[model samples]
Target: MPCGAQAQIIGYDQPDAEGGEGAAQAEPYKPSKRAGRGKGSRRLVVQPYIEVNQVVTAELSPGDDVLTYTEVAAGIDAGISGQRNAVSASVRYERRIGWSDRASDGDAISGIVRGYATVVPGVTIEAGGLATQVNVENGGSALAGGLFDGDSRTNVYSIYGGPSVATRAGDVNINANYRAGFTKVEHSDAFVATPGGAASDVFDKSVVQVADVEAGVAPYDVLPVGLAVAGSFYQEDISNLDQRVRDMQARAMVTVPVSRTVQAVGAIGYEDVEISSRDALRDADGDPVVGSNGRFVTDKSAPRQIAYDVDGLIWDVAVMWRPSRRTSLSAHVGRRYGTTSYGGTLAYAPNDRSQFSVSVYDNVAGFGGHLNRLIDELPDDFEAVRDPITGDLRGCVSSLEGSNCLAGALGSVRSATFRAPGIAASYSRRIGLMNAGIGAGYDRRKFIAAEGTILASANGVIDENYWLAAYISGALGRDAGWSANAYANWLSSSDPLVGDVSGYGVTAAYYRLLTQRLRATAAVGIDGATRDDPAINDIWTASALVGLRYNF
Candidate 1:
């Protein structure tokens, strides 16, 4: 996909991509009504294609030899759209064959699917799943995938779905949802290293469940501001570690129209959080260590819980402005996660052909909490599309899918229940036939294991991550095109058990229309990573490909 299409696939609400940011401002919750009769058989379409590429791998570190390989891949995509239902899905399979005896053959399967339907007048059903590889240093891509090997990639997949109901009680809008999902980490290990440099890999796997409920009543409309009382409850359960967390809040919310192009929202409330988990900690000799306080002595090298339960006051305030069709600014500041938290987004379109955005975020969450947030933001029934490359949902607000377009541009993430804060910025522009985009961001997270019950310890630690990405594409003519992308990422953790690492990669490709339904392509890419710890080796790999794709 082109840079512009990449932005659209990820659901970024850019000025030229989606008519502008005016389509992204927040709106009061309201029950969705059944769709009326419409024309055209709910738009439905299907596409299938096949491709082949020759790849070569090169290592920059000592004692490694260069290797070459060939890969064959095929995929299919389908989408549905209409007044009452929306759906999108795709699947791809690739096989890598090596020419050298030292290199092993492998295969990968990846895709994403999401859809929603109004089952009845006030009820909606929705589900979504993402299957992709996780790179050791750069996380993973939802579309154009990263390199895969024992050193750089692991398979991970997440799937979730549920039913939701929205109804009006007088002027109050009530909404509730119940969703269950599983996050599977296969053929992977969480390597733990002690202070002494001894390391071990423990299999990491788990199941997740989430539920939420909220209701709000708008009582006044005569003033420039509107008032509403809202209450919400959210809970998450992680089966592998036998952990559960809950959050509840009740707040008075106000929405103000500062002017024709400016708006503000404020909320104040009481919030509470609770967590529970099983206790099990052991010493080097395999003996349980008990603290003087009669709890298990937590180990710094192992997962430890924190007493995060909080019951207190919380407030949030935000403002949004679109002074012109080419510019937008929105920001929120508040007390959350038992701490002061803030986030914001700024978007500017200097002309008809370019758009830019920046975003900042801070929050505390339970296991699978991020996934829950994605599900919660979805409307009862809405039209949506996933990035054709990464297979990630574009978003849930109008065609924008909420402010999450910002998150998608920055790159998605994975974390155990924890508190995190981060910021990212991205810009995309098209000059004549050439298009480009760039993005960068950083994040820090403190994990929560278990609190008090033998799991609480003073050894709590945090993980920090930084990343940058860029892409450029241009047309050679109506029948031919070319594109290139580059990305880099670094990760560091306070815990001695986790290693610090950095990685960089680049890819370039050119293609031409061979026939009405066929195209020819050539591409090359590089992947490299290095670990700060001497025990972990540094490596580099490269690949090139020539392929023919047939589409129908």
Candidate 2:
């Protein structure tokens, strides 16, 4: 029998490759609905556009300067939905021409793409990519809007691709998945102000790989209770300090049906996790060597030292409940990585006009691994949110399922391995002709470093981050509309030099259709940032934009 047919019979959904405490369980398959498309049909929409805008910015604090510029941009918004594939992408290129030398001029390319393609009856290909620009302060903090000076701007890129297989062998279901990802930070000059001196250890680049396989039988298929065996592997190689992390695990799971709407699950696993890195190069004076790019020079000849190593048995018990078609909940408490871990996910859709979702997660990884996992979780159908003034990705996507936000993952770019525990929630609703949504999250990281190394000072350090984003849009009659968005972020580090940082921004835009193919827009926004360090002054800027777009 085919996998799809077996899935329908046994109620076994696709296995989650990224295994953790809050793994997904067996559930009925739900088909997504595409606008103006029938079952098993194909549809594609592509819109090419050209835009021109006049922008002005004024520094509100620490200086009195007004700058003016003109922007020319070209972009395409495309989406395709078919029986075997689904894709959505938006790409844009913009050139800025300044009226004066001090106004700053440059070119930027920003975009996002995510999709999946079915290769065969039981195999599929999944891929995603992201490119955006951010302002990095000297204290290792990132600001959302890029209206600041050019010297503080940097670009970030990440891409991941993988293949997944799902099949059935008689009464047993088999599934497997593999993924490889690359992430890079370009022009990063951030540093930490230490009491001894300044330390430059920002994230540079990394490659991450993950794989998982599982074979199982549903309850009552061959026995009274379900049984399964699974194995997984994860690894990440960081260019900074030549750091590496590897984790391997194998487990056996059982499922017991408590009732028609609930089930109890238990799993016992053995896991081996290790983190290792080489020391930085040292000079004759016993000082670490610094490269021209303001980062520590890795000592290739030095032997790798173990930072963290744990090997032991892990166990967890979980509950899965589905009371209705619109409500589902899954939760688990486990012991892994030599510690207690707990996580869960809850989704509730009271009606067609509203949705609510919440998730809690715990993991140990570098910057690249966390980013890749978040991108992989995004839905295939979504609207990319962008800043109105700078046209940069806002770290979030709008969709009917819920707002998928990445603000927590992008909070810090430090080049150290840490254990992260976080929670995120989102709510979206349609009130008459208006649509509104809000997303909020909190993240905490505890650093881990080997003793007797240059990075020993960072050991046991903790950093906390909080972020919120909200947006609302409504129609202003037939061919006109308005939208507003606001965001805020807060960071607190145990290191005194890094201290605390906070930032907030808001933007509103109005558009009107003048003809069948032409549209006019006007927008205004203000962004501000503050740091606890007295030496670093506060920054505030206000910007305005007037633009026209032609669709082809």
Candidate 3:
């Protein structure tokens, strides 16, 4: 029910608490929960809503065209909660068919499903899936922050499911799980050629299959705090590209209480990872190049296909402190992903009415695979449809397809890997009938080349990026409200084709209750981006819309 105008800020760091992928979500003011509300023994709730909007858009730059269009959207939401089971789902479809120009017209279907079932007292089955398409920067998408048609778009879909079991053997608590999943990424056709000369559509597609299993056991009463040992193995097979990766890890973990208000955890482990790809060499005329070994020669100059393996001792330590009931601090340091990494989180409540948090992290991952892992960690709450820190929806959550999905998936495409490290902080509070928040962060991404990529080069594609954002929302009255958000992003890449770039976005929305189940809305948004690359021209875009929604 919390839908409104949204703007993605361009930034140098990961804008979310986890320092993960995707743009940040605006932290709108949240009203306090009404008092005396109680949960029903067994509850099921369903609602349906529809909206129609007339939008007008304008562009900056010479020979630009102004445009107008109508958007129609409909969706349903449902949730069921019981003593041993929980399920929630939402589905929505939207269409925008321009009255004149059809270049930017299309339809989108997005949804999420999450459920958990307890077959026995100590065993559970969990499943979920999500699909979404949105205009975003990076990831081989059409709407990238470049000079060409700035109205680009990308679509992503994924599904995963699995079962978990936990039981006690004497004083040891044991748990295990298995998961499988699939993911697909697609983008609109290119409006212009990339630096490598291939169309944007080449980096536009990928399909991956993932599977993994993990187990752990701990004997808490035997030690001051607790101790455990865990191990996991995962594999990934990619299509539309030639890449296969296998990974495994085993570790001994322990937690200890330092004081009444402080605690710490540490882990020591060994990891084994293997990455391989098929990159066939071709003759000048495009025929396969024969090698002395009677096998196709791998074209290393195009993209390295030789198998690469890395494994070593791994360890990490983390500490958590809660000096007071309303404040907490946590810090983590580890060595993983072929590098040393660290992260921490701090949360404080200045008063009963306001809260602030800061977080920082560093890690490396396959981009597409990391996105799936993020989805795997989503909360089961029905309204937790989108990432609160980053505006990205849980696109791939099909529980039916795999368990512990995303355990081995890598990069959104099979063409590259990313070592991402970043930090972010934000504060939010409510005063009377109004709520507001502000946040900022910086992220640096280093792309490592992979096989079967059509990109000119991967190492310098998307480099340092940073951003800042602010938003405010307040209740107009008992049944009305208004909100506004603004953000700016800057990018500096080593890639000549995508030099320094900057962008900004602003959006505002107001809604009025027409009835108990109906509402009217109006919104306006402006977004623009510029690049220092001489070959690319700067572009700006604006849009305004009026619409209505009804809830069942």
Candidate 4:
């Protein structure tokens, strides 16, 4: 029941990871098995835990073409994207609401709610919610170093809560839960004109709102009869914007008996998407000059299109088999044809000690969004603008004309009203107190223009794909209480074959138990990226923390 705190940093390069739209909206983290202890009465139990987190380093380097991170120069990368030096404090609260157990003389009808707010008491039925809102910075979200010349300050909020009921009939057990939530993005804007002939609002203040609902069920105790079902539905709408969107998904899985020592399980799922946008770039030759003092006036161009509202569906099927308590093998296949598409993964495990796996995904959208998301842009790859005589491409726009051709051409401002498909996979293993994982995947993304967009947004065909990432983690000693982790990532484009990305980082930490319910921890890390001009060099970030837990 890893409820609230979600880790979306893995998607630093994924623009539309938030909503199907190519906007920088808040994203929620998925649930993890390590969230709660393994053994506990199924009936009604509550475990409360807390931890304090902080950032030790925040750095930003953009050598033109803010979208440079999307490139992959190597075959595979082990690096994590979105490198920043940000420091902020956050609190996570969550709860698992489930039915009671019959094996422990429990009523089997009761449940419990967990979180930082209020804990629910034991009862026949239970209801609760999970939410995590954090204020983060980056050029994409308009906070730190702006990517593609766009930067701002904003926060992401994600929340979902519902109710559930579970009961047993004869020799069978059943459980179900339903939840819904929203991801919202807010921003501010103004106008600017450069000598490059570019004149228009440099930023815009708008809000993108998206809503979703998800439900899951599991049945147990019936002759290898473990079964689960889940579904999700979503919609995205922007204020003062002209894009419409909708999405839905449903899935199921079950296990089969192949003897006490052997078991087989499989799952399947499907999803649908729809989106549309028609906007303008400039009203007239100099319509960008409407405002002179930083104020902006809406300019219009004829209605155009990126990718139409496309209805799409994709599915996945997989099976797993275990020969012993320590060994297992599984295969999964997925296929999708939509505005965004993806699929595949196979995994093998020899024991609790080791495993291997691989997978892939891709997504192509309409256009890109600019800083503050107040404007939309083109796919210029505009790295520089040289002076005809001086040959100097130095500095910002020299004038309004330079602005329109070079400034407006920044492609720094962009946002698509829709999305495309994506895929990914990898293998991981645990070896004598140490865990190592390495794998590779590719992303084929399409950038479309946002509806009502007045900036750029080439209404043509353009695609971006890249890959590479590897990682390893392990503990050095029990008496020394030290652990080490490392990884590297690389990316690049296939068609144009120029823009590329590569970086790696490593960290080591030590831990000590201060008390039965409390622990103290410390760690430091170094980072290096080839993409960084002059090589950003070895950046050292450090942190320390004390956490407590309670099982009630």
Please report the candidate that would top TM-score against the real structure.
Answer: 2
Compared with the true structure, what per-residue lDDT tens digits does model 1 show for residues 28-106?
4221211211222377777888867666666656546777777787888777777667776667787878897876788
- For 120-176, candidate 2 gives per-residue lDDT tens digits of 766788788888776766545566644545677777788888777777899887777
Candidate 1 clashing pairs? 56-542, 142-390, 143-389, 143-390, 305-450, 395-401, 396-401, 397-401, 397-402
Positional deviation of residue 510's Cα in model 4 after best superposition, in angstroms: 4.1
lDDT of each: 0.55, 0.75, 0.53, 0.30
Q: How many clashes in each structure? A: 9, 0, 33, 87
Cα RMSD for candidates in order: 7.5, 5.3, 9.9, 18.4
Q: Candidate 1 versus the native: TM-score?
A: 0.75
Better of 2 and 4 by lDDT: 2
Tell me the RMSD of model 3 versus the true structure: 9.9
Name the candidate, 3 or 4, with the larger TM-score value. 3
Candidate 1 segments whose C-alpha is farther than 4 A from its true place: 1-45, 78-80, 87-90, 118-124, 137-145, 163-179, 194-224, 281-306, 322-328, 347-354, 371-416, 430-435, 451-459, 534-536
Give lDDT: candidate 3, residue 477: 75
Model 2's alpha-carbon lDDT is 0.75
Distance from true location, Cα of 328 in model 4, Å: 7.9
Ranking by TM-score: 2, 1, 3, 4
- Global lDDT of model 1: 0.55
Q: Can you rank all candidates by lDDT, best first?
A: 2, 1, 3, 4
- Which lDDT value does model 4 have at 316? 47
lDDT by residue for model 4 over 238-325, one digit each (tens)?
3222444444555555555445433344445666655544443334564533343333333234443434444434544434443332
TM-scores of the candidates are 0.75, 0.91, 0.73, 0.44
lDDT of 3 by residue, 1-552 (tens): 000000000001111222123212211111111111122237688888887777777776544678777778888878787766777787777787677854367676677777666777655666666666544444332222212123444556776666665556776655555556666655433322343243222232233333222223322356555666666655555432355556677777666767655667677888786665555566677654544432234465655464447799888787767666456676777887667777776667657567666656564444444454445544344342222111223222222111112211222232345556776666666688776666566666666544344322554456665666666677987899987766566666665434566766677788899999889888777777776767777768776778778887
